[model samples]
Target: MDEADWLAARFEEQRPHLRAVAYRMLGSQAEADDAVQNSWLRLSGADTADVDNLAGWLTTVVARECLKMLRTRRSRREEPIGDTTAEPSAGDHDVNDPEAEALLADSVGPALMVVLDNLAPAERIAFVLHDIFAVPFDEIAAILERSPAATRQLASRARRRVQGATPPRQVDITRQRQVVQAFLTALREGDFDGLLAVLDPDVLLRDGSAELTPGAAGLLRGARAVGAHALAFSRAARFVQPALVNGAVGLAIVPRGRLIGALGLTFRHDKIVVIEMIADPERLRHVGLAAVGP
Candidate 1:
């Protein structure tokens, strides 16, 4: 086959893998698609007389492109669509058996993503590539520009955080329902004291949309501030209903059944610590009402 035909064949085979990597790096399907397209353009135009390991070469090109996009985005002060509050219902899945459905549900559970989100960018990349996709550390190190030893360290730290972090214990559908129902009741009733009772003393509340202020906005630490924030939201906005977001307790808000926002809550030791409210309209597309009882 001619060089063009050979390259075309290889690109077709690598597209899905490249897209997956790009999506994880950029955290947006649209950006991942663009990164893959740009990689093809570069590959098509490059001189390939002495190039070896085309897959590695293409991946390197794509990684650099993704990094460039990240840098440009940071320089321009563009924030990601951070509203992560909506919880899609279980009915969205069309599983036939209860056991199979339960397993699938557990696989992509919200708690997993929350732990993943807490990871540093490099650590996340390394862990996802190595653990999720089974990519070798040497390859991941190349993409991350670090020694393989350092890459392993990054993955180890991410693993430790995920393993050590406590997930909510109420796995039964009915029990999860009760906990969230209680939480919503407290919020709706404007019972700040009651809400504080269920919150961890060191709870962290993050308004993803707010500008990052040094000790001002973004991260609100302590139960007092967290409770106050919840009270303020309860007073100002009306939450539609609770839902199971990525397998964690979540709530969706609709001003007029038009899906306005979502909130994903994570619990540790039966006390809420992290509250992520996603108000950006664009990010609400994947979220919907909760299907499970809770």
Candidate 2:
């Protein structure tokens, strides 16, 4: 084969890994695909006869492209974050497909995606490369144009935000997670008894979404009433995942990679006493949401 054909083959081989890296950095499949395509363009034009690791070189190129896109996105923050813009759909390939986006969201995890969106461009790049992909700090330092120590600090800061420090509060968080997980599991499985187990006898559920149930309206009182409503809308459980709502364990309703709503839970004596559904676009954009786990 000719040199061009040889390079094309190599580029095709690295496309998957490169796309994965870009997706983590940008949190959008279409943007990630664009970044990877731009990287291929750079590779086709550059002379890499002396380059020992082609994968590393291509990764750096993709990273730079994603960083530019992120900076541009930050500058163009005209609309609110969770205003429910339609996802782009074109060809049959995974990049623009809604089903593919849902699968990717499930794999990388909705909570992580939500948290990564809140990170700064440099912090996101540093944390994803060093912590998630296992890239060296020195290499990441070069990407950020900072010293190795500084790059490490960037990742450290992101790490603390993502994983959180294990203090006394952590114990409470673990207990909360257990209750939330059980609540989710029961709701999804349609286990009425299980739902009652995690719910307090006098549980209160307040839903802010416009489409409130007929009689229930905005507020639901008592465990039996709340459990019944949960079963009625249990289909939404498929899109829900555990997340940190204002520094406590809760649920994030992410569908097709877009965070439409969140369930902020308040617990008392190992039971969920209050479940507030925040679906108002204004509240979703401003609420403090993050990944709940490492």
Candidate 3:
């Protein structure tokens, strides 16, 4: 009815898009919410009487906040990464609620989030806006304070890495689930050969690359080594269940219905070629594993 009420209503309308932008930029639900809140604080304090496009203005504000947050997160590289899960631990948002579930699922997937985390703050801003949300390069450039050409380049680099991390493949979801289930069943039964049977002879198990702990293994070549590691971690398999990882059927390690981590499997010729396990608490918490679980 009044000026303040009209402004509040306008902000509420763009809140979803703002949160989505912040979530993709920051990769944490809490941080995303914080970024959105920060944007509102800025808008409330600033004079937006002359601002023609409130939507674009708010997006830029939220993006700037997210960029600052990303830089802060990167500075504390030495700090132990806390466990992040699809289920926002804040408890303010109920996972059982469909609206809450939609927000949780918006962060691509846990595995992709980890890769996106590796990108520099600006590159992430560029990629997430242009690649994920289809924001124009010129608008993103203004937010990053870089030339449109530079912003486009940043998005290109980030896109290449994202595409590289997740090699494009037409995976059969049903068959992949069966393979994952078979592997898990064998793992529980301690069937080493059975584990090898489901895996490619040249299977790759890439445990850690910038995730939870500094001591995580980089890569394990050959089925035997991969199987041995699988057996070693088999005790945790009881908690694992079939789920989608980056749009493909994989497994989520949910102990007591809490998402601990996710495994992204790459299948070739009906055999597992790559197994990427993300168990770090910080990275795990941001992933939407809880949303796709059994």
- Sorted on TM-score, best first, the list reads 1, 3, 2
For candidate 3, write residues 1-294 as lDDT tens digits. Answer: 998888889998777667767866776655787898999999888899999999999988999998888888788762112212232322334546665455546346545666777789999999988877778999999989999999999999998989888633334667877888899899999999999999999887777644323454476778998898789877878998888764556788879987778886767677888777777776465444423433
- TM values, all candidates: 0.55, 0.49, 0.53
The residue-by-residue lDDT of candidate 2 on 67-89, one tens digit each, is: 88888888986211221111112
lDDT of each: 0.66, 0.76, 0.74
Best by lDDT: 2
Query: In TM-score terms, which candidate is top?
Result: 1
Cα deviation in Å at residue 135, candidate 2?
Answer: 0.6
Question: Candidate 1 — worst ten consecutive residues by lDDT sum?
Answer: 80-89
Could you list the CA RMSD of all candidates, in the order they appear? 8.4, 12.9, 9.0
* Candidate numbers, best lDDT first, in rank order: 2, 3, 1
Error of 3 at 254 (Å): 20
Clashes of 2: 0
lDDT of 1 by residue, 169-247 (tens): 3345555566667777888889988888788898767666875347666778788888877787785446458776645
Clashing pairs in 2: none
Over 4 Å off in model 3, which ranges?
Answer: 78-107, 167-294
